[model samples]
Target: MRVLVVEDETSLAEVVRRGLTREGFVVDVMHDGQDGLWAATESAYDVIVLDIMLPGLDGYQVIARLREAGVWTPVLMLTAVDGEHDQAEAFNLGADDYLTKPFSFVVLVARLRALIRRGAPERPVVLTNGSLSLDPVRRRVLRHGSEIALTPKEFALLTFLMMHAGEVVTKATILDAVWDPAYDGDVNIVEVYVGYLRRKIDTPFAEASIETVRGVGYRLLEAGPAGPAGPAGPAEPAEPAEPA
Candidate 1:
């Protein structure tokens, strides 16, 4: 497989190149962000190993530009800084995988192979269900062309639901995804947040985009519910029915 390694550290870059070459991969190395971005955009690569700290544009900008240019090559971001926010930013910018500094060469190879196996598929910058749209990078939600304010928890719940649009996600699953998996609080919190989302994203627009699945869970409709535009009236009961 052909791979591009974009790292400012010349010594490390050569080491990675030699190791990968030994692993039967055809490797190309770029020492700075500008050169890396140009190589990535101008050539077809099975995958890319990019460093976050670069002299010219930086890793984040490189990945963002690569994606904007419609290059869907899977990218495995390498960075010395390890933080959740940094990881989230990389993912938002279309990075396929991430590895922090001091990582094992074995892990790197395995992750690269896994990414290559997955291949590159275009990922939408904005997620939408009907008139409702969610921009993960900007942390914005809009309904019917107007922006809607949402609390952090409410936003997380909405994001989870929208990501699984048209699927019934159970309370347990939602809790694990949106809330702390170690959370011991009442599971009904999911119902409350779902209600909150409906009020902001659906009720105001006279839409029923989120559907209760009775004993199952909830499904976000792919298209807005058909009806005349008007007040949505009362919010749905926040209590979910017991599974039958």
Candidate 2:
């Protein structure tokens, strides 16, 4: 299989190149993020190994741009930083797998092989409800052509709701999906975030795309809301009072 390794460390890149060549895989190595992005975009490869910190566009930007430009090659990201948020951001930005620095070569080979086997299946790539659009790979959210900034948690919550658009998702389900499964915090936190979403995505535009189902949870309308401030639009059911 063909693999592209984009690591800024020349020694590490050469070592990986040699090791993978010995493992009976064709490997092409690039030493900077810009060169790496160009190679991956300009060539067809089965998979790519990308590093997070690099001169000229970083690994995150490279992956996001690749996905944005319709290059779906599976990417395994390398990062020395071992924070959960970093890993989360990597996946959120279209990384297929992640390996921290000082990783096991054996594990790396195994992961690469696994990604090759999985191949790239073309998913929707963007989630949308009416005029609201969310690009998971780019970590961007847009409403009526205007970008709406969102915190990671809020973005995640909105993604979940859009995924289940038109369905009434319970607070338990929202908590489990958006927050950690073992989250022990108050479930009402979902309500607070939902309110936050409405303020940004709904209220400002005089839209009611997110509907509160009394005694249940919430639902994101599949049709989404009307254009921003265009008209009173159709009347939506009154939202139940948010928890105190």
- Best prediction by TM-score: 2
Off by over 4 Å in 2: 125-244
Total clashing pairs for each candidate: 0, 0
- lDDT by residue (1-244, candidate 1, tens digit) is 9999999999999999999999999999999987887788668899999999999779998887666444679999999999999999999999999999988999999999999999887455687776778776566898778999987677767777777787888988787556643369998888877877777787687677777778877777666543432333435665543233
TM-score of 1: 0.52
**After superposition, which runs of candidate 1 have C-alpha atoms over 4 Å from their true positions?**
125-244
lDDT of 2 by residue, 75-106 (tens): 99999999999999999988999999999999
Q: What are the Cα lDDT values of the candidates? A: 0.81, 0.82
Residue pairs with backbone overlap in model 1: none
Q: How does residue 104 of candidate 1 score in lDDT?
A: 96
